[model samples]
Target: MGGMARYDALLVVSFGGPEKPEDVMPFLENVVRGRGVPRERLLEVEAHYQGVGGVSPINQQCRDLITALRPEVDLPIYWGNRNWHPFLADTLQKMAADGVTRAAAFITAAYSSYSSCRQYLDDIAQARAKVPGAPEIVRLRHYFDHPGFIAAMIDHTREALDRLPEEDRDHARLVFTAHSIPVSMAASSGPSGGAYEAQLRAAASLVAGDRPWDLVWQSRSGPPQVPWLEPDVCDHLATLHAAGTEAVVLVPIGFVSDHMEVVYDLDTEAAGVARDLGMRLTRAATAGTHPRFVSMVRELLEEPEPLPCAATCCPAPRPRGAS
Candidate 1:
């Protein structure tokens, strides 16, 4: 355990979701926190979870990712989430008890933004503070442009395109979607700013190759008065329909799995829009447990120690009522 022998364990950090009906509201509360998401919005989101029988696919997705990852890396794989069960603090406590001194974290979010990157760092810091002798967590660098991620997405997109009507498959437009952070958050996303959108666009381009595509936003939780990224996926689908696009493949470039956001927002809401508009919309699968994405964890661990984000990078967004 000297130079080049950096860590004892591999931590998989993720945004956790509720696994049952009773856990929904508490989980939502954990997510909105001081961000000032409205009560009405929370209620609406709660209904989304309820409609799906109060289970979010996210927690299971995390479990599956960790299960797939264990066989790939030599180190012990431990998973923790920001919001729900297997909480990061609890996971850290167990790691400490297990005699792990240091670890490399592979956060599920693959890009640089307040929510995606810095918040997870803050979570790790908070969790470590609560666990005596918590392992030093070294977060892996952003992997938006990693070949393994891009390849997984590319293959999924092709599959989605194939799901379209044969006459439309060859001409289907690729529509890449990601969660919409507030405009202010997007403005201050990286060292300089705008790194979130830039990295996402880069990934989309790699996945798209020569195919025509557009990057749109989804799962916007901000209040109506405040602007978030847009046009929202549903609205974008309408725009595509109006533009005479015969078919569209929705690629959720923002998420790594088919969680509630992908399930409720895209498959349910956006897909409804596509149906109403008489348009064909096929959603590409997220890179959940995809072989290359699973292997990307090991690849990241094998790379040189990644530099941490700058202190000024991805500053937190102000609460809705803040002046």
Candidate 2:
């Protein structure tokens, strides 16, 4: 195991997505369970999935990542999702059956937030509780700022910029985006608070370097009465168009792959907005199976074990209608 002596296996954890039209609603229900999301809203999001033939690219991306990591690490790599098939509990059952005692978990999310960080840990804990003899699954540290991740983004950003018209390339603004969480959840993220935005800003800065850039949010899914992150990607594109910005490169730094959000939100919705405004736009690819990114997994695995999150870090949001 080399430096991974404390762990017997590496498990890839991700936010699951539906594989077919029939599976869409059920998969979405699992995602929004107990969050009080309106069925109307669920159907609206469901349409986004159906429009793309009801398949989410996330699960396949996870498989590709696992395949890339196999040659880099010696441990048996297992895959599991929080909401869809190959559920965490089932994966844990298999792990236990195989006599795997302890494993290191690498979540697809790279930042700190309730949904991105703590909720995953909570999910793992809950799954372990349900499966007898579940291995001690320790999540790897947040790698939003890791050099390997940054390098991958930088390379992809360059590629996206190249796709723009030659005249627009030099003047194109870089707009980095991520999923937006509710305001209260964002405020309570990480050990102290605001770590979600803080970490994202740090990563965005590293990716943008000296380029003119702005960080925005996308794919917000909460009641209108509540506020999540502001200046959504599409809205920002409109604003940039109005401000006479001719072209932009959208860097989805918040996501690890071209999942549904990246495909529907940025590639579809945001692209439509840009088209309406007659502004040039192209989206930078996520860090999906990039060589440097694949190597990063092994690096994280070989590093010294990470300390557990503080009890209050990235605290979950109180359920809707709570006192």
- Tens digits of per-residue lDDT for model 1, 68-120: 98888888889999999999999999999999999999999998899999999
| lDDT score for residue 286 of model 1 | 95
Alpha-carbon deviation at 169 in model 2, angstroms: 1.3
Q: Write the per-residue lDDT of candidate 2 for residues 1-323, one digit (tens) a residue.
A: 44788889999999989999999999999999888788999999999999989999999999999999999988999998999988999999999999999999999999999999888999999999999999999899999999999999999999999999999998899999999999899899888899999999999999999889999999888888888899899889988988999999999999999999999999899999999999989999999999999999999988888899999898889867779
- The alpha-carbon deviation from the true structure for residue 314 of candidate 1, after best TM-score superposition, in angstroms, is 0.5
How far residue 93's Cα lies from its native spot in candidate 1, in Å, is 0.4
Model 2 RMSD in angstroms = 1.0
Candidate with maximal TM-score: 2
Task: Report the C-alpha displacement of residue 146, candidate 1, in angstroms.
Answer: 0.2
Ten residues in a row with the worst lDDT in model 1? 1-10
What TM-score does prediction 2 earn? 0.98
Q: After superposition, how far is residue 244 of candidate 2 from its true place, in Å?
A: 0.5
Model 1 misplaced regions, further than 4 Å: 1-4, 320-323
